[model samples]
Target chain A: MLRAAGDWTTASIGDAERAIANVVRQARGVKQLNIAGLGQLDTNGAMLLLETAELAGEGQAVALTGVRDEHRRLLEVIAAASVRHTDAPDDGNPVLRVLAEVGETALKLAREGVELLSFSGAATMAIVGLALRPWRIRWRGLVTQLQATGLNALPIVGLLNFLIGVVLAYQSANQLSKFGAELLTVDSVGVGVLRELGVLITAIIVAGRSGSAFTAQIGSMRVNQEIDAMQTIGLDPIEVLCAPRIMALMITLPLLVFFADVMAILGGAVASMFALDITLTQFAKQLQAAVSINHFWVGIVKAPVMAVMIATIGCFHGLKVSSNAASVGQRTTQSVVQSVFFVIAVDAIFSIFFLIIDV
Target chain B: MTSDIPASTHPLAIHVRGLRTQFGSHVVHDDLELAVRRGEVLGIVGGSGTGKSVLLRTIIGLNRPAAGEIEVLGHLTGTGGAAAAKAIRRRWGVLFQDGALFSSLTVAENVEAPLREHSNLSPRLRREVAELKVALVGLPPDANDKYPAELSGGMRKRAGIARALALDPDILFLDEPTAGLDPIGASNFDLLIADLQKSLGLTVVMITHDLDSLYAICDRVAVLIDKKTRIDTIPELMKINHPWIQEYFGGPRGRAAIASAERAGAAV
Candidate 1:
């Protein structure tokens, strides 16, 4: 006869397993096991007892007596589960899995492209409708978004452009001085800063800062079902949520680009004064003579386009977020990455067009 | 009434005395004394803002009481050092409202978290035990690899239970386990808890407003009213004449739950 006693939970399984092993070894000739004295039993404990019974002998079926109904059911569950060996299927063929993943990603990207187009169309219609009914515009929401996406982004954008301008002027001075044409450094700085680096860097920074913020904010609202509540209350989410943000970005991004151009030129002037021994007045005069307003216009022209792309991508990914906390983080990252990528791609296309048409 | 201990050889799973919890002068529980015996299902019920969930959190050391003594499974819960508190925490598991699963992990990995934290089991065996727990909770085998977001509300709840039972805890604390479940699903969950409790000899402390669960599986019901607790069996509680208890136990939903339990041949 064998009696299982005391608690048999996982917390005490180490001692319980040892005790059960000793009991099973001694119970080789025993035919009955009594669980009547078993104070507490869990799945692990029950599994141990079942194994002991099996180890008692092959053909000698040990009868478990004094078994409570609940314990009996538990033992039965463990017994059934043990017999059915259901292992998760292995990932077959590493090459095939990689190919499959690539294919799936491509399909996902194609679907996203279509969705983005439709979203852009809807946003355009909303802007036109709001233009027709000027009073329908949410001025308060527009001002709030302006402060968040525009004013709050000023310091980082200004500082980053300033650093870029200083680096460019220093690097160009080295090569220009070799030919005794150090004054040509002003042309390089003016053209590079105003026509390319200033606006491009500003756009990338805004994409990372404001784009991810949009996704996180709207994704959280979607998670909490606030978006659904808005629709149910007969408010067009596009007009109320997307339009204000888009309009604010469109209006503020151009202004930000103009400010970035000024800061970068100021940085270049300071660098020229320090590195090339050029006076500040001479640097300013050369910069004003070398940089055409056409170059500044070219950079400012890309601002609204980059702004629209970033805002649309951010809000689109946000709306695509499923009702999971994890999805918000994932979508926010996607928003920033996609917005920056598209901004650079569009800027490249614009550069080619400008060169072809001799802007 | 304040210090009466049960005259049993086995210590109570939870013993509370002179519990006072307050938030900015909003008293939640005052002089709240309660005891939960070993191997019993205790259901805590109260209206909204009555501090039922707060009491559960307080006991689990997530929220500190303003003044009280809380002893859980013979360990002073909140008064201990970090290692001591961790040891006590390992002896119990808590299931939060809304399942509160780690959204990043699959169901199987979620169940394996405590095992990995506390035991030296190899990865294979830990995974095997996790699969066994998932099976025990009646989840489909395929759910092992699925994220919490991919599962329905009831399935998520079951996954949460599987994770809570990962370390084979002696005490299981659940917060509104069946709040978003349908009637059949709720009753099934109740049945599962009852079955698990009986098999494991678990001490379950659940905060719920589900009358069906109270009628079906709870061995004792603790009602919080007027900032204190009143603990009694279902029948004993039904006889109490307090206005809140009267309306609660004798209400239409309560009566319907009782009738269903009777039909199912449960001794109410």
Candidate 2:
């Protein structure tokens, strides 16, 4: 026999549940459920009791005693509504399921790739059209975005690359000193910082900071239906929103890369002085002899291309955001990941091209 | 321990006296006095930005009154420590204006949240109880697995109510329950509240601008004006000489709502 006592309201639900569990577990072979001692039962408690009785298995003839009329109504309501069904199970083979999922993702990627190409074409047309009619460009918005994306990112990029330069010089000093060629640490630091690490780190930082900002701003606007409001008033969102940001990034990134290159080299020089006991004069002379002007130009020339990739991917994901709050966060994360990956991949291609042409 | 006291001895489910609420230099309410009796549905009405929703929030301990004594279910709100506040909170359930179900969890999981947090029921029993609450609010069984974003506006409202009723609290607070529903859906919601109130003997406090809901189910109407509340039965409220109340109750929408309620009564 099952007996429940005390208040069965929400306040006492924990104790009530424990009691019900104890009774149900011990009532496997028992038939009659007694509740004459039950006190202060409400709908939640009644539902729990009714559920326990239903779980007593088929043809067990479970009988509930001492139930008042009010509790009985609630039990009937719960019983009438307790029809349970499970969600449909997937019937396909596991191998086929994996293949189907891979195919679906590839198709989605292909579709998005085409969309990105079309957006690039449209953006190029807008840039050309604006060049022909320079009076129509929003110079104020362009300046503001330039300041936000470029000027604000200076300190962080400088500090990070400075630390990278220090670590590189320190490690090179350790290895080169074994060969009694500690002065060669300046050559390694200059070439590495000038040709690759400087521009690569700057691009990655911009993609994370400004690119994610672009996606989050536009994605939130899309979620709030402000994009539709803009279109209603005959404003092309791409021209008004995307163009200024892209122009800002294209103008500011090369300058930031130049700044990053200077900072990284200076950091390498400072580290060389401390680790290899090389004077600043000697470090400068070695950098001038070992790293050619071609190395710096190669890194700077890749800046505009990386800028285009980050800006376009950021704006593309922003415009692609669905009208849900969750989609804004998802699109922002995707923008950062995609832009960083593309920037690195394009940098590798540039490296190969420069190698082939013997730059 | 307080559950053993019969509900009737405490006629006032909610009591607020000398209440004052302010935000910066703006005062939303001052010297406000109101009381909600046991087992009654009280509809709070006012013009936009008149602090009807603020009053509900203050009573439920979501907002603190600047100066006042507010008691719900005989427990003081806002002055209570964490344990006392939690005890009071478990005695009532609140439904926000937009359903406010966690967007990530499915409908069934949303209903199961309070039960999981406050009880030790086995997984199977919790699932059963969640489904029962889902059905009690008149949602389809298939809606159990759907997200809040996937449901229609009316369905989301029902799911919100189901979550509110998950624990069978004595007091149910609803904010703009029928604001976005159509006339038919609004009346159906009113009927649902009336049915649940009768069956469960609930004390309901609703903030609503829907005249039909106020006319359909409210035992009394509280009008917020002049930075305070005026509580009375609907007929008595209509007899007051306040301009806002007159405009609200004598407005075209108000007239239509009253006519519809009369028609529904005559048919019944």
Candidate 3:
């Protein structure tokens, strides 16, 4: 028995070509060239082995020794159309063969599932840790969120609220003036700004800005493999990277909400000053009187909760994204839309509960 | 070019028996046995899927062997005592294929990690030691403060070498150390290795396909074929009559080494 010994490598294209050349030149003198010990041979390597045998003039078979199942399979594939390495002795064991095939399939499924779970779990843990930490002074993750979602977010949030306020004031003013009921415009504007429109418009604006931004940043980091790299270096990707950002947004979002309310009110106040023939001060007083501190504080409280929720969700999805660059863009968009939807849904629930409690 | 323990006159460093490593149902390293002596360079050459990396990982205790006895440097590995396994690792240096330097840490910190983790050296002394090792690898002392990303590929590899030598390990493992380096860089690195081994009396185990390296650095080599490593000294390996050898040494690299040895014989 030939005691199999030594290393192996897959022959390269050049190696295969050379083998073919060697066989062509010496085919007449050889019986079978015993093939063994080449690992990771490519298609070119297979082709060369095949060509070598085919060109081996006549009456020659390349006897393959130490043929690993993979090698034998590859040889069979290459030799399907060409003649080479013809003699592969099979020590048949169906059970072993079935085990190998089934085991590979199971391993693949398990590996993929574990990787998916790893992504989701790691991302969720990072975001939850960030959101739950008390990094803001006002417990005002809400207030800061108002800022990011609403304050530094002002120009965009303000711009959007301005359009909404303008549209509301214009349409309502035109309809009321038709009946010479112009004075009732103050009542319409005051109640509308207080009960729902102001907070609703502002919250939507905040969601689009802060929520989406969070996702993009985290998603890109995921794409770059920085998270995995962090794990390898014994650094907590959440503590070192995500928490501070989440904390910053918490600080930013409530202030964002406060700014959004201002812009939205300004939009309504401007229309009141003009359309209702009420002075800015009178409009302000009327607006303030109509919506109690309860209404304002209620909306205000939702800012931080909303911020935490949006930031958490954004970071979670971003971190959960796949390694590919395309995943970042896709997840970022999803994060923005999902955050906006969740924020509105949560806000509505809170509003209904608070109103019910007050009533 | 330099003497590291008077050529290959070192004691045995690694011993293994009945080693087997499997991935799922596929057995990669089966009933493998090999021993490597200290104070000599042992080269490992293998075909793909022959479990070369698997064998190395098992011997180093990074991956557990399905069935085997591994005694590295007089210590049985894979026992429940993590401290002992870690101490064994602390006494050995490994340079992975891509250097595997911490990207976040400066070169100095990466080198200092093992020292900080295992040694009792003060911070100042550790920094000094790191600088010295960096300089020994022919890197500038300033290279220590630069992140792994700042350095070129060759520089990173050198930095990895510097870090590996930080603990003054008795055994050094280099996996594809010259895989991506230019010929000049690779040759210089080889010379650096020779000098370091000679001066430190280090036992080096290098895995490579570079035939020139086999002739240049290896005192012995093992062919990982047939699911186990069959090691032979360079002189004995040169005369090996096997199918793998027919394709390997019979190829350019093996041929070149033989021709060079003949030339040296003529010169002698």
- The most accurate candidate by TM-score is 2
Restricted to chain B, the TM-score per model reads 0.94, 0.96, 0.91
lDDT of 2 by residue, A1-359 (tens): 66556666766786667767776776675566777677777777777776677665345767887877757777778778766757788667999999999999999999999999999988888877878888868786798899998999999999998988999899999999999999889888888887899999999999999999999888877775446433322246788778889999999999999999888888988999998889999999888888799899989999999999999999989999987999989999999999999999999999999999999
Once superposed on the true structure, which residue ranges of model 3 sit more than 4 Å away at CA?
A1-359, B1-12, B15-19, B57-71, B74-78, B81-89, B113-123, B238-241, B261-268
Instruction: Tell me the lDDT of model 3 at B119.
Output: 73
RMSD of each: 23.3, 23.3, 13.7
Candidate 1 local lDDT, A144-218, one digit each (tens):
899999999999989989989899999999999999999999999999988999999999999999899889988
TM-score of chain A of each: 0.83, 0.93, 0.58
lDDT of 3 at B188: 81
Let me know the DockQ for model 1.
0.01
Against the native complex, each candidate's DockQ, computed on alpha carbons, is 0.01, 0.01, 0.06
- Over B1-268, each residue of candidate 3 has an lDDT whose tens digit, in order, gives 1112222333578888888888789999888888888788988998877777667666766567788898777767776475555556666787776676766569998788677666778999999999999999999878988998899988988888887898788888888788888888887888888899999988898988787777778888989888877788766765777788668877876788779767755897
Clashing pairs in 2: none
Flag the better candidate by DockQ, 2 or 3.
3
The alpha-carbon lDDT assigned to residue B72 of candidate 1 equals 80
lDDT of 3: 0.70
Name the 10 consecutive residues with the lowest summed lDDT in model 2 chain B: B1-10
Judging by lDDT, tell me the better candidate of 1 and 2. 1
Backbone clashes (count) for model 3: 36
